[model samples]
Target: MTRPRIVIGNWKMNPLTPAAATTLATAVAREAGRVVRVGVAPPALFIPVVAEVLRETRVGIYAQDVSAEEKGAFTGQIAATMLTSYVNGTLVGHSEARRYLGDDDERVAKKLIQVLRAGLEAVLCIGEREDEFDAGATEDVLAAQLGAPLHALSESDRDGRMTERFVIAYEPVWAIGTGRPATGEHATAATKTIRRVLEEDGGIDGDAIPILYGGSVTASGAIEFAKAEGIDGALVGGASLKAEEFAGIVRAFA
Candidate 1:
């Protein structure tokens, strides 16, 4: 079966105003036809405005992150329950969260549990750092990053239903925001490695999962990644801030 196509924009702290947020959301919604699955994760504060604009559209709304702790005393953390009423899914274990916010694999595992329990989909980010990549251990690094979180799940959470809501994004730390994206071949190789780890180690039907390539993805570069056999779509960053560029990527995958 063909993996479903999707384009998810991670609008990390931009537009700088509610008016701009809704305007951008409306533009994206206008171009996001009913064909491919399209979603965006805006800053938490902007979610309400963006959601209001996208409510009747086919485009979906998502949260940038959710707290690993379900509730209470984790000051400044947004719980999954708090987001259940707003987003259809949440981005988990993003590299920025891992690098700056201290979300190691264990914490990522906990966040995954929370997102799943709240009945929201998760787009889990996994990749090797520049140093790890330089060591020629991309596959090993990818496996460990992905496996540790998955293995931490209970037997029941590892079942098919859990797999249904999970999406993996392979975004090399070295590639993201560097204006240099991974080649289609490199991304395809990484996707297969992720699939193998999910199936052989995690005991999940890996092929059923949609693995995306996310790294400084732009309209022109998106074509190569979209055409790659195992790459389902993208988790866009910078270029996603612009409606035309983002819609171009959606068209690439479509």
Candidate 2:
């Protein structure tokens, strides 16, 4: 049987202190054995510390973002190798990074390569803007954003590098951190599209690929998504900062 895959939370930019981190870590650890997989992505600064706490516990630690470049004069950038050396893995091409940090598809594609080269899994995020959704271009936008990068990979990159080697996260831009979530139907449809694209262009075996839903995934909201076909897990935002909330969300699979 295929086991459920659920990522508990992504504590983006909150919980700046050690005390706060410890509290959340303790909560996830308390209920770690309930799910197939549980992970937390804290701010880059605390990745090492959080990773230490999650070690030997049920939760895995991750960095929220990483640079496409392995090393160089890109001031203020954290390279994939550095993140892999410190944390278990890192998130790439998140909506915030695409919106604020000017990460285009080309850059994200490079980052995906970097993450894999460094021996860490890449949570490659793809999503549509609210305007695109309003214009009924959600599918088009998602295809371009999610499929283009991997499709652009060279033959070697596709066969040896990315084929079934990364996690795809579908996060609707409007839902992220806005306290609103894409309806279960919407998320399910989008994820299905993502899987089809991967199979068609990237040669990623559908059964081996894991597609995670992001954007405002809550304990109550997660149940419906957990039951959706093709939804392997979630890339949670706000709720991951609190241990209890994240644990509850994980329990949805149980």
Q: Please tell me which predicted candidate would have the highest TM-score against the true structure.
A: 1
Name the TM-score of candidate 1: 0.97
Question: TM-score of each candidate?
Answer: 0.97, 0.92
Instruction: For candidate 2, write residues 3-108 as lDDT tens digits.
Output: 3585747888889797788777777788766546878887877777777777778677888888888899999988887876667677889998999989999899
Off by over 4 Å in 2: 1-4, 160-164, 177-180
Lowest summed lDDT across 10 adjacent residues in model 1 is found at 174-183
* Model 2 alpha-carbon miss at residue 78, Å: 1.1
Q: What is the lDDT of residue 26 in candidate 1?
A: 93
Worst 10 residues of 2 by lDDT: 156-165
* lDDT tens digits, residue span 1-254, model 1: 67789899999988799999999999999899666799999999999999999999999898989999989999899999999898999999999999999999999999998998888999999999888888999999999988888888888777678777899988899997675557999999999999999988888888899998888899999999988979999999988899999999999999
RMSD of every prediction: 1.0, 1.9
lDDT of 2 at 87: 73
| Cα displacement (Å) at residue 223, model 1 | 0.3
